[model samples]
Target: MTNLLRWTTPDLALTFVLDDGPVRLIAVREASQPRGGEPDPSQPLVEVAAVGHGHSSNRHAGTVLGRQLRYARHDETETTLRIVQEELTTGLRVTSVFEARAGVRAWTEASIIGPGSLELTNLSSLVIGLASIDAELYSAANSWMAENRWSKRVLRDVLADIVRDPHHHVANSRHAVTGTNSWSTGETLPVGVLVDRSTPYALGWQIEHNGPWHYEFGENRRGGYLLLSGPTDHEHQWSVEITAGKPFTTVPVSLVVGTDVDSVFAALTRQRRAIRTRRPIDDRMPVVFNDFMNTLRGDPTTEKLLPLIDAAAEVGADYFCVDAGWYAEGDWWNTVGAWEPSTTRFPNGLAEVINRIHQHRMVPGIWLEPEVIGVRSPIADELPDDAFLTRHGKRVAENGRYLLDLRSPAARKHLDTTVDRLVDEFGIGFFKFDNNTMTGPGTDKGGTSLGHGLLEHNRALLSWLDAIQERHPDLLIENCASGAMRMDYAMLSRLHLQSTSDQEHPLLYAPISAAAPAAVLPEQAGNWAYPITGTTREEFTFALVNGIPGRLYLSGHLNRMTPAELDLVRSALTAHRAVLDDLHTLVPAWPLGLPMWTDDWIALALNGVDVSYLTLWHRAPGPSTITLPIPRSKIAPHFPTDLGDWTYAWNDDALVINANTPEPAARVLRLE
Candidate 1:
């Protein structure tokens, strides 16, 4: 007899069945829907394989629909469920855990209970099979300065060729979207949505891993299946040897089902907050002013920073960060391992500049690239070979820097000392941890495969960060990999903020900022607002508008701006502070729809309970008015209310805002 177990949220439900075979996902639907009434049942909840010492021992496993197994035991909590099952012949126990809330978080653990060791290969965190035959897929293709570029495609486009009439023995081909190395989000986001065309149902999920991950969609006898996994042997040379007493667990993956994309995204937003290790600073989304963007450009001197610090504090900025090159002399990229105060840049020491920032009631912060040791730095020779990532006994160097293996005690100690010294010596309350280089596949040390070693190292890095947070409970950290190259939830779940982009052009950055909420939470999205001198008032408004809906990361030469430009900056800051408290409970939506790389106009709305904030930018010549999706309501200009030329009109079901000016203009509005 098949025993059925269930987990559900107010809007979603997931059902699993345990029988004399492997555990299988029976149904995933809205709370009011029936169980998997579909006919197909070959898909399993999780997939695993055991590669033994001999060829005869290899077993290819899929859905537990046909295989024979024995149910061991089960455990349950209000929000979580765990079930254990043992293979009939191999004695391998597979434990699957499911957590329910706004979404379902699930993962699989493999353990060998018998005497012999087992080689595990091709393990997936979760495999969700959809019975809907004509489903459309939605996923984002991300890259540097071009993050969160989403596209929608029909399942038939990718799986149609493999689904034949009635061959019975036809082979199934898989269409995979995979990413490699520590920059898990460098190529594509670890998220996807499968929506049925005929119905208002969709399944969305995010693979929560910071390192290499793989997700694929293929046609199965039971409609189609989606596989979410970590590093695999074929992609990352990854495999693990599980002993009798040890257990291996894959990274977590989240699943949510709803009637449409908006509802699914809303559930995901709640899931993101639920899984995060909350901190006090998250509640207070402070405005940060960094000297790197269009300002000092990382060449901060005591003389150059004093006026900027005053300007930043005058504008009500809460934190001031001294970006890169703060500790370097001239050519500092390759000699950046030893983070020390430069005698030339700071004649009175970096402490003097930081103290000035403190005098203005702003917290002092600095940038640190903690994962790499420069090739020319003395620390490269000071640390042992084991401290650095090695491939075949040779240190792996990329972009003139050697990647540090956080798994090494020596490397962890070094980073700990550096972070501690900065916090203790300078009263630093924030640190921007940036990674600029990628370490190919992974390391070959520690008696593990290259991909396995990288996985362990990534896990160790997270553990080290947890220790740091434990010591400094109030400290805030911003996760940046050359501006969001590693913007997966695995890192954002622990970090306080996410740097949205590195694109310097204010016009080009508008779309990136508008689309950021699709991948990151609104309060955590760090959008840069750098208004340079000599630009028009519209241009200044364009720059400031980018930061209004999210964390306003102020930049530009504010100290050199005229009184009018300065007032514009202060006005944006005032508006941002007014909405900071309300932003905590708001979820994001696209009214004019998701921005394209070359869209003429972009729109983003932070939808709150009774009120909402909307930001619109016109980048190219187009229609003077763009209709919004929200209903007709009272609308007011939120920022730069003094712009007398701009106007808006709300019809029955649409709010049309007209940008009286030409292209490269923006406005922030409050809708009720």
Candidate 2:
């Protein structure tokens, strides 16, 4: 009889069978499927391949395939399975750990117990084999402005062709998606979903590494396999020597099985919340007014900011932030270290501005790019070379800024002093932590590989953030990497808010704000609303509607606007706050499907328990109307009720609406 280990949640179940030789995944199904089906014995539970000094052990050659030395299980609401396997010849011990919550998270640790060292050429964090060859792969292709562009293709389309004459076995074809360097989501998001075309089963997984990582799918002899991993030698020049009594742990990866795409996303959402770090200020979800877009444009002075702060508070903004250029004089981008208050920008001291912001009853915030030291700053020479990231005995500079190595004590001390002084002296409550530049591959400071150095620095950066938050528990941090370039869950899971985009054009930014919920939570998404002076009423409404569905990051020169324009801004903020409670529990759904790069009409609906909120935009010059996915019950304008009139009707199974206005128009509606 096959000894099987089982773990189940309310909607998902996973089973592993140990058949005396190796442990293999027997079943992974949703609630609709029956339990205890026949187990597939072709593939093992964990696949680990390594090579050392001309000796190589491929994934299929791991000791787990020979015989399991011992096994144990731990139960505490969630289930954890620990299996230990030993290679008798090499004296290598491999421990596989599987944690089951709403989904399954697995990883492996390879330890050298003998006198010889081992070099790992290839290592996978997790691998799961499925019984389906007819599957379609789905992944998001992301970039700076065009983020989360998902595409799908069949497995056979990219598979290698082979003759199936029943005479010889065909080699498996591998298809991989990889991201290099420190920007985790610089190229593609660390997410993928595989759906069985012929059945209702789908498998999804995400690599939770902040540095370089890769995931691939390949055909095996039985069916197919999915492999997820972190950095490797060929890609990021990563490798580590395992000495005696030392063990190496790979990156963590999460896996979930569901009946369809929606179910897969639901499982992922639960898993994301399960792993997120707890914070106190997450429940507030305040509206922020930033003086960046179309206002000061990073050139804030005493004269330009005091009026804006008063105007922001008058319009019901909870937090008022003064963006970049507050700490420097003229041409200050390359001379930005030290973070001292500019003597020229503020005649008295920055304290006057902070006091004025507090008098207006708004939280005072400032912009900080903490990871880089300016090349022309005097502080650059004061710090030792080890304080910055080095390549080959020289500091690595990008765009006239040197990257700070958080692993160094001197670097951490400098940042802690700067942040603590700002909070204590200025009474600051919010910080916009911006990373404007990217250090290419990695650093080589401590006789380590560039990839390994970058991995350490990334982890160290998170640790520094934890320290800062612990010190100032009331402070909120906005994660901005030139506006969502490094916008991955690794940062979002810890940071308080995510700046969705920096696109200047209001009409072009509509689709970006509409599609942001797929990558970030609604309450954490910070979408900008920058309505300039010369835009039409429709265009002004278009810009203001972009920020209503998410956290309304208010911008533009409200102090210089007309009374009518100011009323529109206030109306939008009022409507946003009215529905803020529902947004906490709402899940995003694309009613008209996900927006295209240049869709004429774009829509995003946040489905809640009692009511749903929808934001619609019309960008084309011709007449157009969108039919939503849900049945029309009652539709009312939730924001800027004074806009030009529109028309709507309840179709059979969808809600149809016509903007009836000219180009570049939008509306925010409440559906009940």
Candidate 3:
């Protein structure tokens, strides 16, 4: 047997077998890879002689379903793998899986979920040979899909800033350098910003020990597929549905960096290990509140005097939200760069209002689209030539504001400065990052664009988020790309919550588009109640309690409330706090409708107190049937979770119920 080159991370490991009969690989380590040592030439990476066999003629692994991956596989064999050893040198780290089946590609298998899935997959087909790989040559761009949007000049403009300055500050800020507008350049230079030999690299990127940065690692999805890929076309995708009074759910990123591969694998071995399956830091029901945006910018006022949020909160709301114009006296849509107090109305500054709300015994929350900048702002003018992210020598635009480029160290630095001032100094508790832009811009090549660099920018942004999280371990970040387009596993890993959309009118979300967070992400228990125009204020209060299976959220302007509405809102919050104490886990059950287009969304079954509750939604609404998978914990002896029908519903997903409307609904189907 030839000596295998074994490599590992905290959790997985692989070894390459050199043979004529097909390149073979084995999973030798399911535990953390060697922490700090040379690759032990003594052991096999895994305990398999399985050959890497695949359909000779297959397309690349599609970004999602219909698309193809870099590699393809035939049903080889199923062998379990466990981590045997892992080592990390100052410049290198290695991991080995001892018992893994032969040649089951790391990301190619279904074992990985959520952010881990994206991280593990290098391309559609190829899993790297070790824990880490560096690239002397690399491409930092979106994919082919992006080439059309941003030209080369815009990308060049961006690279100039990223290289010269790499941080964004609240004080040292620029409106043109945030969010999806993280534009970059093409007239390339050697990217040599390494300390010692250790540097950060996403999985699947090929690396050589020595060389200038000039390697190409193919097809890396920042998270998983694109949410809003080509203009929302004719997929006519249905909004996710749940049982009438039933609820539907989806995932968000939740991970705990374990101490070793064994510990990490051990976390995975748990039955609840899925994409969005980690434990929630909080387990309280969200309270109902309202924001008053009566077409403040000439959109349309939510009817009803004073609105329902205050009334909802006074009675029982846990969250109170203030929308866009609250801080803007005029058409401040152009005032995003300077996140300051609106001296005209909010005279005492936001703190006074927050203090009052806290005194009212309510959790104070504020909203911000942190990665966006308006055309007219001090940031654009003050920022030097080497600041904002640009593509083809121009700023990227969304809604009307230019998306900020987070890749710039200066951009990150500026972001930290502003955020620290606003959050740390201002004492704000929550953040809602809204993206009103389209998912534009991809990668770049030479002095032009090949459309794949967008992912690079996003990955860099994620890196920043990771750094930011390290700063304010408990700070809450909300993901809002129009609604669902940007809500992928990558950003989810760090965000504590999300605001479903900017269109706070509950009515707008009625037939629920997949864009609605409540339809997909259960963790983001958010609801947009028009100031007035809701079920009785009590019903509004009820809505708040009902939205989040484990927390509370509301969107209404507080200052616009009447005394009566205030009392009503306060009372509802009290009621929700009581039901929140009983949640331990969340499980997905059958959704309300049949799967639609590309979405197979369903319900989230949560363990509250002693019983489990299902919040459901389906892509297509109908009298259709569904068979859900029950966990081993809920199974009868040894039956697979997808067995038995217990009708309208079908095993652990066994409870049968009538079809509810095709919109998002919450059902209290109790489980033992």
Candidate 4:
């Protein structure tokens, strides 16, 4: 007879089969739902692939070593569970740990004693067999200025049905999504959702790593399986030689279950909040005016900034950030590293401009790319060879910049001295840390694999960020990589805000802003709202509305705008501050499904306790009226207060918006 072991949380339940063979994780479902039938025996709790030993049957599943391991012991607590398995021959032990937080998080740990050596290529963080094969996949493609472009596809469309023969052999091919290099979201997001077509069952997961990660949905003999991992030798050239005393641990991942896309994303939003470090700056959600998007565009001089600083203060901005070029004398792109303020750009001195921002009762912030030292930078030659990432005794150079190895004491000291001197010299409270280059496969430093070496550098970078935050408790930092390339939990969980995109056009920016909440928290999504001085009223409001829903990242030339335009900007900030009152408790919902890049009509709603807020965008001229499936409530214009040409009413519990404007337009409505 087969023995069964079960664990239950308030919202989720897991069932495992403890047999003579390897421990099999059979079912994972809602606690209130019933276990349908017998557990599937093909699903192993842990899957590992090494250099010497491969799989027993298929290249993807049925690992021989994984099947040979047997359960040894288990332990559980109010919010954590640990299961241990051992292979008697190699004396290798694997421990699978699960934690119950806002959602379920899991990881794997391995150690060996008598085994001479094992070079591991692949190690799974979590694997579970699905109940059915009929499911839809939801994933997003990310890029420089265009981020979070999500698309949905049927499972059969990607995972082919090849079980036509009498043998019923499972295919090894998988619908995989992988991310490489230093930018976690440079190619694809580290999160996805699998929703069952026939039932309401939906599963969502996010791999929490600052480096490479892999996840796949494929089939085995019994049914479909979802595998989540960090890095693999085949994909990322990452491998670790595990000796007798040296053990390895996989990166962590979080899993959540819900009914549909909205619910699943809501749970994910909560999980993001649960993992984030609590800081007073994040809670305040202050309005930051960055003079880069459409105004200075990396050319900030004392003469150009004094007037903008006055305009930002007049409009009630809490933080004024002088973005790129502030520290550049001339042609500073490839000569960046010693972050001293440019004497030529500021004429009177950068401190005079920084002090002017302080005189206006706003925190002064500046931009810095701390990870890379330009090829021409003197610091690049000043630091020792070991201070930078090197392969074959040569430094790794990409896009005219040399990557810094934070693990080196020299590199850390250089960064520490630069940051401390700037903070003390100017009373700087904010930093927009930008990364523009990518490390191809990492560095093979210290006789480690390139992937493992990059992994160490990633962790070391996080440690450095932690140290800086500890030393400067009141300082706030923004995580940026060109745009949203590094927009993952590993950075979001620690940083104060995220730059959603560097897209300049407001019309093109609406879709990104609407879909960003699915990946980033509402208060942390730093959406840029740069209202041009010469645009029409509708065009100007369209840009301002883009920033009102998330972190109102104000930009554009307020000094050049007419008095009427500046009033509109002030009104948008007022509406954003009101939304921040309930932003933490509110969850995001798409009245229209996940937006398309060129969708004529888009709707994003932030559902709250007593009152909710909704933003509607009519991007094209053809669609005069669009119906939105939202709760029926009294609606009032939150921003501008003047409805201009747009009008709305309730049909049952759905919203019907009539775009009376002839041109493109957008608006934020308060629903109560």
Winner on lDDT between 2 and 3 is 2
The models' CA-based lDDT, in order, is 0.82, 0.78, 0.36, 0.88
Candidate 4: where is the Cα deviation over 4 Å? 34-41, 56-59, 164-166
State candidate 3's TM-score.
0.52
Give each model a TM-score.
0.96, 0.92, 0.52, 0.98
Q: What is the lDDT of candidate 3?
A: 0.36
Question: What is the Å distance of residue 618 in model 1 from its true position?
Answer: 1.4
Model 3 regions lying over 4 Å from their true place? 1-18, 21-58, 61-313, 316-319, 442-453, 501-521, 524-552, 556-584, 591-610, 615-671
In candidate 3, what residue range of length 10 has the lowest lDDT sum?
224-233
TM-score of decoy 1:
0.96
Local error of candidate 4 at residue 277 (angstroms): 1.1
Which candidate number has the best lDDT? 4
In model 2, which regions exceed 4 Å deviation? Answer: 20-22, 37-43, 53-79, 100-102, 164-166, 169-171, 243-245, 642-645
Residue pairs in candidate 4 whose N, alpha carbon or C atoms collide under 3 angstroms: none
What is the C-alpha local distance difference test score of candidate 2? 0.78
CA displacement after TM-score superposition, residue 213 of candidate 4 (Å): 0.5
lDDT of 2 by residue, 1-672 (tens): 767766675656777766555566657777457766554745666555445322232223232323343333333355676666566566666677777756777777887776986666555676666675688887877777666676778887886757645686545556778888777887887888788898788888888777798877666556766767888765777766665676788878888877666557657766766666758787788899999987898899999999999899988899999899999888887888899999899998898899999998899999999999999999899889988999998999999999999999999999999999999999899999888888888997888778778878888998899899999989999988778777766777788888987887888788888877767777888999998876788888889998988888999999999988998888988888977878866777777766787788888888777898888888986567778767757778787674365677888878888777757688888888
On TM-score, the leading prediction is 4
* Candidate 3 structure quality by residue, lDDT tens digits, 224-288: 11011110001111121112232211111112222332222123222112333233333343453
From the highest lDDT down, the ranking of the candidates is 4, 1, 2, 3
